[model samples]
Target: MEQEQQTICPWCMTEIVWDEEIGPEKHCPHCDNELSGYRTLQIGLDQDDQAEDEDEEDTSDEPEWDAGDEDESYGGNGSAWKDTDQGFRHTNRAWMAVEETLRRVVDEQEEAPECPSCREYMIEAGKQKLNVEPTVHGAVGRPLVQSPIETTLYVCPSCFNTSSILSDKDRERMLKALSPQD
Candidate 1:
């Protein structure tokens, strides 16, 4: 089995594919921060594992809540806050959804690629086509030719650093389009 080497950017904590090609001015491809003396850190699925471990621990001393327990504890009408129990349940569900979304966003940030310039997490901005049109010198009836190069763009949310690169397939297409036709 081949072990893949990886490194994390100290500034952004983004995982980077380790390559010796990085020179003395070694900059993170994601955050563009110097990595000369930085040490590699291990990342694991420890958060989930820890959570599972806690769930498995005994908690028999904790009191379980019954229906209308909140009203009994507070000595107030529960319906004063919400019309029905179903309404409270719906609100709880909505809050749970919101919490889940927040968790997902944080997870995405943890896994996001670092911005080369800003050392922050970069997000996919959009796809754009860079067209290189052939210059025409007043040609009569010659069809205009242009090569459309498609590229994916990423942007740093912090420093607004933007990067664009063509995919392998797009590079092949661009090369074919630019090459002289038979």
Candidate 2:
């Protein structure tokens, strides 16, 4: 039996195949663009060919650490603040969403948050379980009060971090209703 020619994407170099279901003369599914050229017995940029292009150097010179790294990581240059400084401290990317959700939960019925001892409002960024759940189920009909997902808390103003758990029962119920669905 003979095989039809295989094409590759110019942008991504992934092998392309035409599928009747996808449509005739389809784009390289890998890159989702038009396909051109015919398949050869062997195709793609060989190692030596790729290496040649890679050897070409950037025209401009820059400091080793300064090149190809995010400026924010470098403390925006020459500031007295270091990585440990409050200003330089990490903000959990999800902070605002988590804090507002938690605050709304606080506003609703039942349990009071132990009112974080920290001087500032605390934000819930993401959660983790520092310890393992006890495996054995207490009773079949009774739903296990699954352990809390340990969460990292950050102070709203300082972004100082801490953590605690509502009781297993409370945490389970609160998480179902308050935490982001997705």
On lDDT, the leading prediction is: 1
Cα lDDT of model 1 by residue, 8-82, tens digit: 778888877754454223687777778776768676776888867887785577567656557653346664556
Pairs of residues clashing in candidate 2:
none
In candidate 1, how many Å is residue 108 off?
6.6
Please give, for residues 54-167, the per-residue lDDT of candidate 2 as tens digits.
766543465556534646656666343564565665668699777777678555624333435555545444445555463543433333335544544433434454655444
Off by over 4 Å in 1: 1-113, 133-146, 173-182
TM-score of each: 0.29, 0.21
lDDT per model vs. reference: 0.65, 0.54
Q: Which stretches of candidate 2 lie over 4 Å from their true place?
A: 1-115, 129-131, 135-144, 147-156, 159-161, 166-170, 173-182
- Give the Å shift of residue 169 in candidate 2: 9.0
Highest TM-score scorer: 1
